[model samples]
Target chain A: MDSAAADRPPLLEVEHVSFRYGPLPVLTDVSLAIREGDFLAIIGPNGSGKTTLLKIILGLLKPESGRILFQGRDIASGGVRPKIGYIPQKATHFDPLFPASVREVVSMAFQASKRGLSRRQGEEAAIRRALEVVGMAEAMDRRIGRLSGGQQQRVFIARAIVDKPRALFLDEPTTGVDAGTQDLFYELLDRLNKREGLTIALITHDIGIVDRHITQVACLNQRLVYHGSHAEFCRSDTLKEMLAGGHHLVSHVH
Target chain B: MGAFLTYSFLQRALGAGLFISLACAVLGVFLILRKDAMIGDGLAHITFAGVALGLFLRMMPLAVALVFSIAASLGIMKLKERAGLYGDTAIAIVSSSGLALGLILATLSRNPGVALLNYLFGEILAIDTVEVVLSVALAAAVVAVIAVNYRKLMFMTFDRESAQVAGVRVRRLDALITVLTSVTIVLGMKVVGILLVSALIVIPAAAGLLRASSFKKAILLACGVATASVAAGLAAAFALDLPASGTIVLVNLILFGVLAARRTPRA
Candidate 1:
């Protein structure tokens, strides 16, 4: 939120990242940086490698050539990963056959981080706080698949942030939700960014999110076409160029 | 029932059957939730080849079958990962190869005989003490791994990609599941035969998923269903003069039918 926050060191950086699927290139020399407390949206058309970049950053996929740094350290060195969380694309559509309660769903974050044979400790408070933050504390014991789409999305957000990760990444999180919930969802991201100072990165084709909530924008179509503050992105002709280039952009209203 | 239990062979069969059922039921919950339920059937077919190879070599049949099934399970995983084949496609290729190889070996062997017949359609009543001990040991190992890694496995099953991001070691856990499923399948072949072994791994778990409100309950319900079915199916087989393997699967199918028919709220 600070105007000169970019002057400070970046919290996360992607340097000279390139990725390919066999012979086809998905991303080419894509590079970007996220400063602390910034709400950045990685905007791109459908095939623009947005999710691929996110996967690379999350260490789910190895880029063909690149290095990812968290707090100026190579992430591949196998130290403790900088505390970060992810809510994957289409997360709300998780198998209905997964018979876990809302509490159990949130508890998975802790379960993944736990070590040794020691029993789960202090995670109860963490789970409760996360549920309360998402306002799903009342549904803690309910089956996750039984919730409405919006509610499930919030529960996923809680699961993502339950560990108090310094950074949160989301991928097309509002694909099937109604418009009403999308507005509230963006507002929730806004609150987390402003109040908690959590660094946030989201990938979506929705151009409206770029205008409304995000502080920085990184436009992608196989390359880093534009990366700047929201004000600069709006003041430039880049949006016009992207539109004329026939890249798909969904313009929606809250 | 008491009189039947008095027979030593009946006791051996019952003990081995119950343990194998518990192992299958627990692992089945994961297999069903992960949508990899058919891996059990695939591995069972592979077990058929393993048994044939054991017969051909005149070796410890269960040991050779165990090795064959585990290797084939790993092969299925590799085919999915490295070969870029769809999961079911890879399973189909590996399982059919196993069946074909098994048939060939049986044809080539001078006396494939009732020993092979017994494995194809389980002869639990004639199970030896060594096989019962092996069944109990392997089943306990499978159940222990599930208990120890239950939470991590649950996370991976719920959302594999997110679980990887969370550093849950998805690949290792996936390998662990396949290997454990391999063990369960090999043990289950003795109780329900290679043809019907997957029924023990899939049906009870499906029944649990049908109505349980939580994962813990689902596992508990699946175990209960599997244990009861095996017990009743074995008794019915004795009383009605039927094959235990077929009877066990029929009971499982009937229970699944009853569960499916019950009314429940759906999201």
Candidate 2:
């Protein structure tokens, strides 16, 4: 496959976006252009507006000013929202006692897919394939509430990828999972980006783990500080300063 | 047993018990899933106000009560969403206001005699043919909606944000389910009255949770427990010539106690 195909018209573009939550500015003059097949890791300290940026991209939060474009079209203009999938930071907001099988949770992602296939067969196949991708195929029949935190997170990831979305937004997907499980999770995401060419935007606070796995990094603290490659981000003095809680630093590393 | 089956009032009591049990059991599942069991209690009190207002206006109490309860449910939902009021606080506000309003209306009415007690505790034997028809219709409607949108409702209940992200219209579904729950509450009010109707929603579902491994099984078991309680309660009420509402609630309490005991691990 030609690498140039990934460099086509940017898949997502946030132009001069600003958002405030009741007089408190969360994001100001935030702008970013995400290319296809990029594993973009957004890193920042607590309350740094990292998750807010991802929410804007997913159209969950509206910007007070400016526009977000998806495939060169305004995202708010009904431009095929099904192409985007989101894994929320708190998937446990789902009732722990509510009974649902892993397969049922995973297959629900394809509910919006355009495939006109048999509902049962299509859902089953998609669930199986997604679970297999996340190494959770064996636990398909298990109740979601009974699974461990790592296993539950993997199930959610499977749900996100089952639809074959153009872009995947994961908010702290490895928050409570062990280091080994987190490593496996990132490896699966890396494979999806490398082999299947899926675009991923992850919001995480673990800078150390991210430094080793992410291809691109964007550091946020309410505004854009710098935008470039991951190598540049690791070497940047501004990031070091921001990490020390000195000032705002929003850098996009390619 | 033969004498109990022959009386018209006993037959009506039995029918009302069956209807309330089935409807409350189904609605109870959603309540438990949403973690808004208190909302059931709140709505039942609101339905009490509707019942009182219906009697005062000399209208078909059930119809008036249904309309008023559905409206109250919608109001509570809107307040929670728009004002960002916590669900429990919103329920409290609606319930207390409703109870107050009902009390005022009953006080101003001419014949506040048995009607007030009926709304408070329930009057299962008073269920007429119209109430029976309405109960059956509402139960069928609840079943139809649940059957058709089981997956959608389950998805919404599990993770509302993801459901919205998947284009499931979370707000609309939430409101719809609330309306459905209000209908169930109103139907239940006719049997167990407002004070006891909410118990019918919680006890069976809590019992079902102890034993069932899946959502469907839990719901089915809840319905079974509720139905059994209703039947046994109605029979005991007729045999002892006691109040049907007290009898039904006693039966539920007994079931709950037995289930809780069975779940306890031996030292």
Candidate 3:
């Protein structure tokens, strides 16, 4: 709201956002901000409107009230609608009958991202590099349906970041994922966060693996129930309440 | 066989068949993948009303059918949005109404039975030079739109909600596909009759998906299978004194049976 706040803008800002489906109120005055290079985890129950908020921030859903600012510019009418990489909550349900190659799926980033995939290097080079990042270079030409669920998920992640997006949003990425592969996924996300400085906003009902990785946590239940730093979150009474509600970090199963 | 080829009627029939096959096969793969195959069926029913209206008014049937089918397709989309109806529900409502209206109109017209039978069963041999030209032009337009927007359309097909979030202009692409499919149905009605036109749009693509290892292969296989089936079906129609539309659909069913029996690539 002031000039001083404009100097160092957060990567994304959800300012007093609210939404509803028909007459039913889904989200009410929810707000949060993600600074550059921050890995923020949004934890909520099934009906707590986590995915709805993510959709609004991703510009897929229009909020009934309030504004979303990406890099301090209004997302609704902003000139620069930042290139955001998204892994949908239901990414796993992709019909197996659809015969698309792993390479072909990732190549979507070429058309999707406004960041302009590759001007200097050839398109194949970009595809290869992205595959390599996800440890899927060997499976580039393989039919997507032939890969395991975890492997397909990695391919989707590769697709998301192939164009070098500024922010990555993962909506309940761990559901149905095996524990071992889930650890690997978190490690990959951690590497992307710490090494590449890629900002991430992960939405999940489960918050076990991400607890150690996230810098901030926003727990939602149809409203802004908790919004604070991870350290403060660990010590606050809200964390106890969350734990009482069975929202505690689920330990990785060996 | 040679006599059939030399006849101008047969030549026009074959030309229209091939062009419609190309359009249907290409568009069908996307429609089937998007779970919109029933759209073909729905549009075909809508075209029936268009045809009856045209016959009653003494106007060009195909042109009227094209306009009506396109309008009906858009209407289904609008109803789905405004009424919170599911896609299949919207299609069912519009298509059943269109079919009923066509039946009522046909009953009200002079020589109603003969007019209805001609359009329902199709008379490809009676398709004039002008009809052939119109069929080719409409088919070409559908193919061109798909070719230009292949990638974007593919994105929408597999995951429309995600595509919308990713800024793929989902509604525009939805409208484009609906229009293309309606036009394809109009052209295909001449090839296989209104009753079996959807068979042309769904079966070839269904067979293609049974064996394709990738998106490109599915498309190529569908188009190849469709055009070849049309050729062979036309030949059989002449040899057996059967309707080309029925023969073509029979050929497609056989192809689908063979392909479905094959193993699919799995994880």
Give the winner by lDDT. Answer: 1
DockQ of each: 0.57, 0.35, 0.44
**CA lDDT, every model vs. true structure:** 0.88, 0.80, 0.84
Candidate 2 at residue A200, lDDT?
Answer: 85
In candidate 3, list every pair of residues with a backbone clash: none
lDDT of 1 at A132: 92
Write candidate 1's Cα lDDT for B1-267 as tens digits.
998788898889999999999999999999998889999989999999999999999998889999999999999999999999965999999999999999999888778989999998898889989989989999998999888888889888998888888888888998999999999999999998899899999999999888888888889999988998989998999889999999988999999899899948853
> Of the candidates shown, which would achieve the greatest TM-score relative to the real structure?
1
lDDT for each residue of candidate 2 in A35-64, tens digit (9 for 90 to 100): 887778887767878888877777788889
Model 3 chain A weakest lDDT span, ten residues long: A112-121
Supply the global lDDT for candidate 1. Answer: 0.88
> Fraction of native Cα contacts kept in each candidate?
0.70, 0.38, 0.50
Q: Candidate 3 — which residues are off by over 4 angstroms?
A: A1-8, A78-80, A113-121, A244-246, A249-254, B1-4, B113-115, B264-267
- Tens-digit lDDT track of model 1 for A89-207: 87987887689999889988876666523557778888999999888999988999999899999999999999889899999889988888988988988889999989999998876
TM-score comparison, 1 vs 3, better candidate: 1
- Residue-pair clash count for candidate 3: 0
Against the true structure, what is each candidate's TM-score?
0.93, 0.89, 0.92
The number of the candidate with the highest DockQ is 1
As a whole number from 0 to 100, the lDDT of residue A190 in candidate 2 is 82
